[model samples]
Target: MASNWLLLRCRCGQSFGARQGTKPSCSRCGESSQITTTAVFTDPNTLTEAVANANLPSEISQQIENKLNEKKRKKLKSRDIANAGTIQRILKQSTDERGVLTLQSLRVCLDIEGVTEPSAEQIIGMAELQGVVHRAGEDEWKWLA
Candidate 1:
């Protein structure tokens, strides 16, 4: 027996399968729409291909792409910021300078440790986000705690 499933693409880029004749809601953004029989498929492969070629309205597609990119950026930012070694190095290097941290100082510390991982900008960005540092000037950073 051929199994029938409805393929759905939400404005937020979330895709899922649902039963026919049901109004499915996007888990990501809470948008819902009634399923049409034309969107139902018996073959999963054909459903995948159809979803890939589906001509979404340009505005909706753009919104979906932007949401996806934002999610990716946030994930990377969190990963970079959560590096314990980097945070400890920055804190240690800033101690002698009366808690005044600079991008150059952080870079030098990373270099001395033979860790050329995250760039100076990324480290500084993470520090700012953590509320441990703030811009003192164009090229200087003040350590908050």
Candidate 2:
């Protein structure tokens, strides 16, 4: 049977494929890159057991899983903030008689349930990147449209 290879991207933007259980170096930067696996297999007939039993301890494995889950959750939140009407609503609420919106005021106006200030800032950064808003002063932002 043919061995399955996993694709990896290096920090230098180089992409390559490597067989399982191997750490490949980036051809362009000569930096060692870690392999990321997407699936877990408990079949006794497969090499999964050996891989799981390898030098990786249960504690390290749990930490890695937690970090991956948090990363995925943050990515989903960013996508939702970008696609949702968040930018429009913020702009509408912030553009009033004052004609200026401070970052703190914008955060309060957003009223996103259970959202942290850092997460709200990230969403605002994404909006700025998309040209939906721009910084007018140190703590103020001006709506583009």
Q: State the local distance difference test value for candidate 1.
A: 0.67
**Each candidate's TM vs. the true structure?**
0.39, 0.35
Instruction: Give me the runs in candidate 2 sitting further than 4 Å from their true place.
Output: 1-83, 112-118
Task: Measure candidate 1: CA RMSD.
Answer: 12.7
* Top candidate (lDDT): 1
True lDDT of residue 130, candidate 2: 93
lDDT by residue for model 2 over 48-132, one digit each (tens)? Answer: 3344344246448778999998987787675444335655565567565656667677677656532344455776687689987
Please give, for residues 16-131, the per-residue lDDT of candidate 1 as tens digits: 56656556776457778642334778887777666656634554778899999888766666454436776676557754446677777777776665454577787778778988
lDDT score, candidate 2, position 119: 52
**Backbone clashes in model 1:** 0
